[model samples]
Target: MELSSLKFYNVIVLGFAFMLMFTGFQTCGMVEQTVLKSYRNDSIVNGTVTYNGDGYTSLAIIYVVFAFANWLAPSVVSVLGNKFSMVAGGITYTLYLSSFIKPITATLYIGSVLIGFGAADKQRIPLYIGLTSVCALGTALLLILRSHPIQKLEVGDPEEDQPSEEEEETSDEAAMLNDSLDVTHRLSWKLFLTRDMMILSITFFYTGLELTFFSGVYSTCVGATERFGEDSDKLVGLTGIMIGVGEILGGALFGIFGKKTIRYGRDPIVLMGGAIHMVTFLLIFLNIPDLAPLNKTPDSAYITPNTYLAVACGFLLGFADACFNTQCYSIIGTSYPDNSAPAFALFKFEQSLAAAIGFAYSSHLVLKWQLLILVIFAVAGVVAFFVVERKVRSRAEPSGSSYRNI
Candidate 1:
């Protein structure tokens, strides 16, 4: 919030930190594909029957838990503050990851918890500012939990910020009156319900779906490949490597060029990202078809979308997706152009909720119908593209006066 913190070098440092920090967690950004990894490992340890049924349902449950957890994160953070939330995330992550080395049932349950904890990590990414903001907070919270006991942060008395018991009733009455008085709000609900936010939400949702597919589902499938006569943990590891690389490249590209494109405005980058995402989804989805036996030949089976191709898709999306996400956040947080908590809160809420919806839908669809989930992602991509052009930019009426609506 300080002017000095917004300096160019500070911006660069902050951006750099975000990338480095993410490199460690390697955020499952479309990491659902990695489900293939755990599935493979579990099959090896516990045998093949684990892979026989709708194991994909487990992935779906993981996602649903993550979405629900993340949806509640902001409200939790509001009560607990960034400091406590970070601590909680770290503890949850450690517990989740710890389950991996344990018994079969423990691993799945632990991973699910970790996924939910990780969702909070996603929600809090945009709120904190300064150097290495995301990682610093993530590390601080998680590390403290691992290293030390859960002594609560002395975040001042909650009552300090709240109305007294007597005043609470009066405040509630005032809120009721305010609600009754405003039938048609002076501002367009459209401003509050602007197309840009909706567009960003849709695009980000697809991003979430792609992420979950890799991190959650693909790993499961890859792990279970032996059921279909292909067993390669090395292949699964390579998949993990691909995801890490994609996220770093994607984030770095965004940090480097996102601002430069901001002057011409954020719309171009968003649309370009959407188009690329559509192609990427098609490419990945095409892999499934290519895997079909009919597509195979004696000398060399028809190759599915390569890991490199998927990684490249993620990298490009990072570059393009950053513009829309960043612009949308800035618009909501600063639209009022003043110290209005509601303005920023609305923006933060949107980001968290969209992520939740995206994760949930992606998980559910992938379970209900496997590769077909890509079509849903495609539809979201198109929606983002259409919303930006048809609903958003086209509907705007130019005004001579520039008024801050915060």
Candidate 2:
């Protein structure tokens, strides 16, 4: 649909909200991961034997909490609704970020715990409180507009009067009641054990695993090399920026062309992303141009062609990530419209669990082996997805519809 279409106003608002909120969260997360490594090397935190590793360990432990919290998210969303759930998530995020304001080890751990709760709800607090405040304001504005007299927009129709405050309150109460009922039903194994869920879960596992590698280990790999020397940390941070750039481009591309891709089913887009991701992994596995440290001056260290190649790989990784993630979300939403709450909760659960595992082992794995493992998972996820799509199409063809009844 056209961006200006009034029918898509809610979509527009939600899209902006996602962008504004995620930008802050992702940037802060990148900094946190990068600094975790940097701090370990420099002993930046007081009263900590190893600040760097402890930082990551803290996050990993929290992710374990997050996996369990996924089951609680629907209830939270049901009660607070998306807007208020986000607001509550934002508050938790604010608390976590504030912990960093003082740079104490204890505070950092506390912040990690608080953020874990936010992450369970898939909310990332903005680094700047002002940004979170703006989101809250925007949400409030939307709520007001939803209830405002001008919402009717029927210029000369006397038949329809603006809803009264009591009427509005009643409407909201009814919605909340319905949502609560929906949440109470709970997900069944029968509904959760389908081929589609299996395929999606595997891919989501890879998503979690891949993200940890990038955010947790990729920078360390670059920085640990003898060539980047002390400048490794800085370059690692730069690579994070490149990944973000690719993610923006990838998300925009998918947003613009997703409708066309949907006609072919979600598999094509997902496979395309997986293929791109594999190529990037292969580059890392081969160690193209050799990223080993060369003991060069800090200013000259990052000027090499190999460094740029790593940055380029980061971009492709983000781009491919966007493609995979967007298609998965679209498919799940469309396939299980009625049961989407549980479907997404399971999705997040799988992703968070896989991420926790990845983080726990990242410090110990060899780079080539890690890439090898990811590549294998990537192929498996794609194969499973392809099989699921084929079955879905075959069933749909006999029924004379584009999608099967899940």
lDDT of candidates 1 onward, in order: 0.44, 0.63
Q: Please list the residue runs of candidate 1 whose C-alpha ends up more than 4 Å from where it truly belongs after superposition.
A: 1-63, 69-75, 78-81, 110-115, 118-201, 218-232, 253-256, 288-324, 327-372, 376-397, 400-406
lDDT of 1 by residue, 86-148 (tens): 656654544433333322554555465565621122322232222134445544533322222
* Reference-based TM-score, model 2: 0.74
lDDT of 2 by residue, 1-406 (tens): 3434643676666666656555544545555544444344455457665542354565576677788776666667767776677667765655655554334577777766776721111122233354445444444434421211244546688656656865887679857866664653356344567767876678779888887776656655665554544455567667778888888888887766676656767788888999998988877655422222111122222244366777788888888888877876776776677887677777777888887888777555556667778899889878876776677678678978755222
Off by over 4 Å in 2: 1-20, 40-53, 78-81, 117-185, 229-231, 288-305, 402-406
Worst 10 contiguous positions by lDDT, candidate 1: 292-301
By lDDT, the best candidate is 2
